[model samples]
Target: MLGTDDELSYWVLVLTGPQRGKVWLVTAVGAYPYPYPQPEAHGFAEWVQHWKTHDGWWS
Candidate 1:
């Protein structure tokens, strides 16, 4: 449930937590075109890093 309107060209990140916790991280590429898909787009690197950084083997 993350996407930008035509008026705004940016990426939206939706992080849904357990038990209905949700977060959104919205940022603009600033006139540059983003060639990535929506779900696998923003915060993936950081997400992976954080996942490995904190939740190692706990999942």
Candidate 2:
């Protein structure tokens, strides 16, 4: 899920997967999915990371 804090004016990211669950504080800056995974390594973390980075949740 994705949401924002009106007072703080920041974005939030919630991630859930088979391997783990995590939350991230996102900003409208930076590039797409800082750490991308290769075709051979498609783990849960990599899957979530790809979306988190490329999806532009902060935007």
List per-prediction Cα lDDT, in the order shown.
0.37, 0.39
Residue-by-residue lDDT tens digits, candidate 1, 1-59: 34454545433344454312222334454432122233323244544454457742112
Top of the candidates by lDDT: 2
Q: For model 2, what is the error of residue 45's alpha carbon versus the real structure, in angstroms, after optimal superposition?
A: 0.4
TM-score of each: 0.22, 0.25
Candidate 2 residue-wise lDDT, 1-59, digit = tens: 34454544332333555322434444465212222222232334644565677854333
Clashes of 1: 0
The per-candidate count of clashes, in order, stands at 0, 1
Which 10-residue window in model 2 sums to the lowest lDDT? 30-39
